[model samples]
Target: MTPPRLRPLAAALALLAAAAGVLAAPAPAAAQSAADVAVAREIFIEGSEFAKQGNWDQARERYERSLAIKRAPITLYSLGVAQQQTGLLVEALESFRAFLVEPSAPATKEYEPLARQAVQDLERRVAALEIRLSPGNVAGLAVKLDGVTVPVAALDRPRMINPGTHVVTASARGYREVRRSVSAAPGSRAILVLNLERDGVARPAAGPRAVAPRGLPAGEVAAAEPAAGNLVPIALLVGGLTTFAAGVAVGLVGVVNASDAPTRDGDAADAARAQALAGDLVAGAGLAAAGAGALVLLLGRPPESAPRAPAPRAAVSPLGLTVRF
Candidate 1:
């Protein structure tokens, strides 16, 4: 037996319990397995408990897991709340939009206005960033916003983002990378410009050929200018030529000694034989070194007309969702 005034309170309690039951169940269109429904219910309950304790991160994680297992309007709304609490305004806005688009039910009908209000608030809070590339249409150009790759198609338009400092990086093959830091306030729009320069062309006449060595004549230095960065090959060539000349001089002396040895004593003949062997070894080594230096010089010489590498297009990572009312 209940008092007359308490009868209304009892009816309200019964209606609230019915609403909770409806919220826990899957939508009419959802064909989730019984086991998945049970698991999602359990996780959703855990998330609710965490939210009550003001542990938004834990709540968000549990709600995300529950949603992954089974998506429910109630879970989406709860996830949006958690995301809003965690300062993810952009994500919260998306979650709220997703929730509002779900099939309306008596249990979720009350959340529609709330989700719409949150969306409006978040729309005002989120910031937008527009990125521009100098000398546009660069080949193999890759752009990243706060370490996440931005899609090329989205570059022409402003990107919705959270209010904070963001780092933008732009890079391309054979071009110097450009990085810029931008600060975005709530409801503000920012523009970032990236100017990329060709790499390794600051000095076209760089390397050893740029300067003439001490004691070298200007005419000889000018002649050597055709070979860029060819200092090592030139050094090897010079060393080989000097060695070959010494070997030739030694071999001639040995030949003279050998020719004179047949007329001299036995000891003189033995000395001449040793000298000839040494000269042959030195001459063979000099020939091999000279050949290697020549080969290296010929191979290392830069081509006069080389084609530029084809620029490769970078793959862009997708961000955000297309939401329609």
Candidate 2:
């Protein structure tokens, strides 16, 4: 009953309906359970609707969920499209690449070129960053990108990231963790250098041993080089002073005694002279100890400390992706 000119239009409509029918039956390779297929189809339908409304974020979310449920090449391509619309150039590029690499099937043959084109276009619009520690072989060194650990082997390679701010952290067992934020523009490269310092050496010695207490005049503070107290010098001084006192007391006893005869003399006079000689020897030892103590206190070196500098820290928060390509 159709007019001759409308026959071609009717044929086209019939073909389109047939294609829809074919798509309605999940492709054999999809291999998803009935429940999975149902969920995936529903979510895919919602994503398509959102795409039609230009609600790209919602569309991307739905597409992502569908892809998670079932790894369909069609969903991946659609997900890539949604990502592109949402200003996620890097994500779109990844999705497109994922789609193309998925096992090729007859159903997905027609869209491969679209994926390739998208990848090519996005390649020129993203940024790359290289992170390195000054001493790459620092023991126990660990690096993280956005809090996810990055392997040591990958540290030398540049990461292709979205054009925005990203946080990178480098840490080690005995060294302070280094955190830095970098802003990347489209088609630009950013290099981040982390110079880590040993834990106690990363800050000025602001503890009790700080050369100057805060609020004191600059000159007075500089002149105040007192330690919390060095145990070595105090120990030596105490020992020397004690020895010197003991020697002096022994010598005083010797001076008070008159025993100067012989070591074997059993008489009181001989005993007194022996005691006096012993006292003199003790006093001489005391004098030597006291002199040594004074020399140590005056000439011994002050405590040696590793110089410290203020540490630099920055935090990288999630920033909205800038639309590129």
Candidate 3:
């Protein structure tokens, strides 16, 4: 008796309703673990009590616990409210963001303005700092800012720093520690670059001079003297002299033997041996001279004269030219 089109439409509506019912069914006994549900209930009760007592910090902690257990929108909304009341604008903004992710979230119109205001206030309180590494070298080093150690994984990552002057230090084994003072303003950023180098052994003391905080100026580059315990030059000198003397002595013996020989064949062999010995002596003498020169250069003294001149006086002419005779 019913029309064909109406019957088909009714059947389709029934099927869709069945599917919705299945999807919206409560959690099954096997699906809802008793321990998890208990934890969630406990967190909700504790958070409610804390909020009723006007203890915002305790309320925030309980709400965070509830979030960790189960991310319910109502719990998140309450947490955001508590965080905002406690002046934790950043935390409130994050909480509201989490609540908005739920499809069945309630009170969209009421919470939207609050979340936006929290975000705006948080932005004003935070500062961005640019950290640059000199020479783009960041190997085997650790960087720290304001007593908080930054992870090596976060190197070159721009950070949101709190407003104030902060102590920045870069340190590595086998290298000098580089440190500097940096200041950051609200909603502003400061750039800090660090360069470090390997530290060498200190040279022996030079003559007395004015000591600056970071050692002497460039013009006061004092010549570094070799330590008395450096045995390399002495060893080279001894070895070269011994070889030279032995070669000369052997050459003299070969020459004497060649002159005394009666047979021309034996004389030729002795002369050849003498020539080889003289060549070795010459090579050893060259090495000895090089070793001595290196020692002298290493132990040399720098000139003590000051080379600075007084500044020239300006002329009072229209062209501002000074006349030099």
Global lDDT of each model?
0.74, 0.68, 0.59
Give the per-residue lDDT of model 1 (tens digit) for 99-183.
Answer: 9989988776766777788898899999999999875688898999989999888899999989999999988887778888899
User: Candidate 1 at 40: error in angstroms?
Assistant: 1.7
Runs in model 2 deviating more than 4 A are 1-31, 103-106, 201-325
C-alpha RMSD (angstroms) for model 3: 25.0
What tens-digit string does per-residue lDDT give for candidate 2 at 1-325? Answer: 3331212233233323332333356646648787877787777777776766667789789888987877677787777877776668888989889989888766666567667877888898889999878667888989998888999998899988888988988888877778888899998988888877666422333334334457776566434443323345565567766766776676666545544434445576566666666766765665665565566558645334422322234444544332111
Which of the two, 1 or 2, has more TM-score?
1
Quantify how close model 1 is to the true structure by its C-alpha RMSD in Å: 18.1
Q: Which residue pairs in candidate 2 have backbone atoms (N, alpha carbon, C) closer than 3 angstroms, thus clashing?
A: 251-279, 254-276, 258-272, 258-273, 259-272, 259-273, 259-274, 260-273
Which of the predicted structures, 2 or 3, would earn the higher TM-score when compared with the native? 2
For each candidate, what TM-score against the reference? 0.56, 0.54, 0.43
lDDT of 3 at 112: 48
What lDDT, from 0 to 1, does candidate 1 have?
Answer: 0.74
Sort the predicted structures by lDDT, highest score first.
1, 2, 3
What clash pairs does model 3 have? none
Q: Relative to the unseen true structure, what is the C-alpha lDDT of residue 273 in candidate 1, on a scale of 0 to 100?
A: 67
**In model 3, which regions exceed 4 Å deviation?**
1-34, 77-92, 107-109, 144-157, 163-169, 176-183, 197-325
Residue pairs with backbone overlap in model 1: none
Residue range with the least summed lDDT across 10 consecutive positions in model 2? 3-12
